[model samples]
Structures are given as C-alpha cells and as structure tokens.
Target: MDIAFFTDRRNDLGESPVWDARRGWLWWVDIRLNRILAADALGVVQREWTYSQPVGSIGLAMGGKVLVAAFADHFALIADDGHAQPIVAPDIGEGAIRFNDGKADRQGRFLSGTMQHGGQAEALAGVWRLERGGSATRLETGMKLANSICFSPCGHWLYLSDTLEGVIRRYAYDPETGALGPREAFFDCNTIGAAPDGATVDSEGRLWAALVTRQQIGCISPEGELLRTIDLPVPFPACPAFGGADMATLYVTTIADSGHKLKSDHPDAGRMLAITGLGARGIAEAIYHT
Candidate 1:
C-alpha cells in the first residue's frame, strides 16, 4: 500500500508523535510553537493546548496526567485538567536545555534526553529516567543532541540517536533497572541526514527511523541492516510511530521550516502522514503511573 494522505495541521517543528492506546488518541508536540497536539485516528486535530514554555515530549502519567519535558524547568506533570507541576529540575549551569524525543522502557519507566540548546557538549546532556514517585536519575551523558530513543523488543538493547553526531547507537540495557551499558554504533546516516530523529520498534523487533534531513523513513533490522527507504514529500520527517487499532498505520510528523525553505516546495511540509499496510504491530510504549 502507498501513503494514504497528508494532513496539514500546520505543526511548527513537530517533534514527537505517540499513540495513546488507552485514550485512543495520538499525542504529539510542536516544539517551536510550544504546543501539545492531540489527534483522532483519522489524523484530524482533536485539541491543542499551549504551554507556558516549550515542551519536547510527553509521557503518560498514572493519575490521568502527563509528564512533560520542560525547556526551562526540569520535569513537569501536566494533568488532564490542564494544571502543570514541576517535578524535577536540572542544573545546566549557563544555558537551559529542552527535553527531546522520549519513550518508556518495557518496564514502564519514563526515559528522556536533553539538548544543549546554547551550551557545550561536555555539559553532560543525555537521557534520564523518572522512576516511581517522580524520582529522577541520569542514564547516559556526553551527547550533543539526543533525539530518537526506544527499547528493543526483548528489552535487552536501547537505540538512541545523536542527531548532531550523525549516529544512532545501540547499548546493552538492564531491563529491570533501566540501566544502559556501553554504547556501540548501530547505523550511521551521515551520508544523508544530520542524524536519525525518532524511531519505533515493530512487533518483529525491527526499527523504523525518520531520517530527518534526507526526507525519508528507514526500516532497519535488529542487526542494523537497512531494509527499506521510503521517501517523504516533506523536507524534515521529524518522528514516526507505529499506531492504529492494529498498529499497522505508520504515523509520521514532518517539519516545514522557514530556515530550510521547504514551504515553497511541499505545501504539506508541516503535516502528518498515514502510511497504511505496514503489516506490523509495534511494541506498546511504556506508560508512567506517578
């Protein structure tokens, strides 16, 4: 099957797209616009909420709330009622960082990363985990920009994208503690894009990555083999998630930037795409309770 259609919800720098199984909604974010986006199954915008500050990604909270990554504050819990609370704050010293693409492990812990918006690489920007009761712990560090992050089907490996570094690395992970071991290069997309943006694991344990700069989506095997490349009409295919009732629909979020001059070419640049017949169910992303 081919791409069904594209919807221009006009997302400004859309970053992450997640499928809320319980609510049957797609939760995503437009970082530059500082807004959270919710959409129905048909790719129609259901509701949009403005944030006090830019939010990178959102995690499902236990009490019908969401754990959000704040660019200025640390970690904030935004309730379904629209109230938000600060849960954790990072000491970046000079400049502030925004939480980027994040996902939960199979064990249900929230794991997210940070970007050094106006700082140095040694600033120790990396992924962190929010344990029960909102306890925070650092998982990895010394990365320029952290984007796509997901766990393997067996929970034995973690695929993390360093956009600036142009490498998507895989690390051995401890499923029980959510600890990441040493990292090894999985796939290097330097020839095409700056780096991989967001990725999701299929039920068969394969990874599908949104190749940001190249305007393509890559289907890679667990062994780091490039299986397929589907070109996108948009300039920046920011993030992709496998969702829909049967998890057969591949929902992708694209960014049409003034800097990239993409608007003149693909009018639907800042839109979402629903590519059906993926013929695969993805592993359920973990949810947070506290």
Candidate 2:
C-alpha cells in the first residue's frame, strides 16, 4: 500500500494514535513532547494542546470530557475546554504504575495499561479498567509492557500486547460486568526486533499489530493465523487505526528516534502514516462524548 506523507516533523515519541470519528480528525500524543495533537484527514494540524505531564493515551469518556492516562501522576479528565483534572492517582504502594496506551470499550469502560518506571521488573505493569464515576480496577497484572490495549468488534474479546515478551494475549470479556476471564496465548511474536506494541481490530475481527523494530504491521486472523504483512515507510510503527468516513483508511503511528534514535535520513520516522487499499474490514470508531 502507498502511504501519503503527512509531515516530516517527526515526534520524539509518538504513540496512542487514534481517530476521533465524531470530530472527523486524528488525535495523537508525543510522549516526550508532552503534547496532544489533532489533525485533519489531509494531515493538517487542526488543534493542539500541551500538557504539563506526559500523556500516555486519550479516549472518549461517558461525558463530553476525555479520559487521559497521565504518565506520572494518574488518570486525568480532560475537558473539551482544555482543562485537566486528576481522576485517579497512581497508588505506588499498591503497585502504582504509570499509565500507557489505552482506549474505551463498547461498554463505556476505559481500558488502559500501566508500566512501572525506575527499573522495575516487567511483571509489575498491568492493565486496568475504569468506569464512569467509579474506581480503577486491575484486570491483568504481572505484565512486561502493557501496551496495545484494544477490544474486538463484538466486544467479547479483549486484546493486550506486551512489547517486552512480544506476546498478544486474549481474554474472554463479559461486557456487561466488564470482567475478564482466563488468559490464553493469542499470538506469540518471537522474532528478533519484532515486538508487538499497539493493536487494532478490523470489522472482520482480524488483529493488526504494530511491530516496532521490524518496521511492519502484522495482520493476523482471529484464529491466530498470520494472513499478510504491510511494509511501513519507516521503522518503529507505534500504533494503527482504521479511519475515514467508511473506516477504510489504515492510519499508523511510528517512533522515529526513540529506540534506535535515527540520526540521518527519513525525518518522517515519528510522524503518522496513512495507507489506502488495505481491503480489510474496519470496526466502528467510538467517541468519548455522547
């Protein structure tokens, strides 16, 4: 697939790339930049907001406000007016971990993951769930790098990717109770420099995972079969999303210099990517506000 160059001003660490269907725009964050940005379909910067703290992820909440995974302090409620309020702070004693890539499930619960900083072991990270006007609950614990948190089209299955162990585990989810069942190996990525980061589910229930170091996104079937692969223009593709009015456009985000820290050539490393003709089923996009 051919990708249209959006911008060459790469981000130091671009992540959690999502499409806000209600606003018809793409929203993403530069973790190192401490900034949240929105852009039009044509890759035009429509709006931007800088945060005093590092924002790991952003998703639509029950109200008009947005839910943010504040890296250091805790989860924040970001109003449309650009105001931020801490909803839940990390309880370090009870395994206080920094929030990472997260999204909203169909049942209106915020599904986010956490990573322990300061040289903590990989097993300390976890995936948490937050309901409206409720407390945060840990869904899965002992995760290496709890990233790539997403739900299937039917909302019956939840996918979590651990970049460190390069494993994508699936859990049977009860949407009504927001409960997760036994964990099973969904997909095992054991290739060198091909760890799974962020993921998205297509309308067909197919999983598309971003392999950061290998510079390609893996398209796997629900039965855990490798269907095909899409080559990316640059290495370190952070996340992927299907957007456009029909949800046919495949949008991807990459990390330019975070790991290898590319020095020369290909300045579009950290910028987002748009690819057409993917010919895959795309799930419906969600918004935080009703």
Candidate 3:
C-alpha cells in the first residue's frame, strides 16, 4: 500500500482518528493541544473545536452529537457549537489520570479508558462503559496505559492494549450484555521492539495496530500472527482508522516530536496520513446511543 500525506497541519499528540460516516468527515484529537478537528476526505478542515482541557477521544453519538472524553475524567455530549452537556464525571482520584482512547460498542454503549499523564506509573487506570442515562461502569482496571480499545467486526471480541506492557489482549465479547470475558494474550508488540498504540479492526477481522516507536502499523491475524507491516514516515504513529466512502482508505495520525532535534529530523511527524489501494474495507463505527 502506498502511503500519502493527508494534511500539513501537525498535532502535538494526534490520536483517535474517527470516521464520521454520517457527515462524511474524519475527526481526530490533539491531546496536548486540547483541540478536536474535523476534516474532509481531501484533508480540508471543515470544523475545529478547542477545549479548556485536553480532549482525549471522541465517538459519534445519537442525534448528531458527539461523545467526548475530556481531560480529568469528564465525559460529555458535545454539539456542533462546542457546547458540552455533562454526561458522567468519573472520579479517578488523584495522581494524573485522564481519558485516553475510546469508542462506541456495537450495542451503542460508549467505551473509554484512561492513562497516567507524563507516562508515569501511578495507580492502574481503568476502562469505563457509559450507559444511555449517564451512568458509568468500570469495565476493566489495573492498566497503566489503556489504549487500542476496539471491537471485532462481528462484536465477538474486544481488543485492549497496554502500551507500557507492550501487549494486546483480546476478550470474548457479549454484544447483548456488553460484557467482556477473560482476556487472552493476542499480540506482543515487544517482539518488534515497539509499543502498541491505537488500533482498529477491519472487515476481515484483521487487527491493524500502530506500533508507536517502530514507525509502522502492524497487521495481525485473529490468531495473533503478524501478517504485514506498513512503514510510516513519522516515528510515532499514534492511531489508525478506516475511512472514505468505500471504507478502504486507511487514515493514520501521528505524534509531534517535541524535541528540536527530533522535530527537525522528522518534520512530518505530526501530520495526518492516508493509505489507499489496500483493498481492505472497514466496518461502520458503532454509534453511541446516549
């Protein structure tokens, strides 16, 4: 697959590339910049929303709104005007915990997880499930960095990754009950000397994971075998999502190298990228019903 630059705009911490099929737009967040950006498939900025605090991730909600996981454990329903209606306030007590990567499940429940700021190991952050009426349930705990929270195309498995642990685990999913069974080791990023970041499942049940330090996306089979690797121009590719009308266009977001030397070496580190002609189709993102 040939990789191409999608946008010149750089993000300090670009993560969570979400395809809004209803609006035909791609949405993502710059966690360090505290901003959410929406752009067309051609990389034209259509709308931008700035927040007072870091905005970790976003998922499409019912009635044309968005479910936002804001910094410091704030989850809200945000309108186009950037007005956020409080949904749930999870109390993650002290020590630099914030929402990181999240999305909606097939059953329309919003699922999000948290991580320790500055990559320090404090308490184990947790993954949460938000119901329609604004009630939050802790799904999984004991994770230092929770990421790559996505489900299989059939919603039969839930994938979760701990970047610090350098492993991705899979759990049997109950779509009707919104429950996750015992987790089994799915993939080991340590094998490639990389940390697994954000990820998505393609229509064929293949898992595409961003190997942050390796500057590539690793495609793996459901049985945890490495299938292929897509090299990236940037050093820290944070996340990937399948977009475009046919859902074959793979969109990637990267992190900006903060140091002057690294930034000078990789100027395009934080830019968005698109991989085309891969012939891989993606399932529609599940919508948050609440």
Separate clash counts for every candidate: 0, 3, 0
The 10-residue segment with the lowest total lDDT in model 3? 257-266
Best by the lDDT measure:
3
TM-score head-to-head 2 vs 3, winner: 3
What order do candidates take by lDDT, descending?
Answer: 3, 1, 2
Q: How much is the lDDT of residue 271 in candidate 3?
A: 93
Candidate 2 residue-wise lDDT, 174-228, digit = tens? 9889888999889888743478888999999999999876889999899988788
Tell me the TM-score of each prediction against the true structure: 0.91, 0.91, 0.95
RMSD of each: 2.3, 2.5, 2.0
Better of 1 and 3 by TM-score: 3
lDDT score for residue 157 of model 3: 93
lDDT of 3 by residue, 1-290 (tens): 78999877888888888998888899998887888898987889988888888887888887767645545477888888877787878876466778889878888888888987555555578788887677888899888888998999889899999888999999998998887899789998998898999999899999999998888999999888999998888788889999999999999999885222224247677999999987698888988886
Model 1 residue 50 distance off true place after TM-score fit, in angstroms: 0.3
Model 2 steric clash pairs? 60-288, 61-288, 203-281
Q: What residue pairs clash in candidate 3, if any at all? A: none
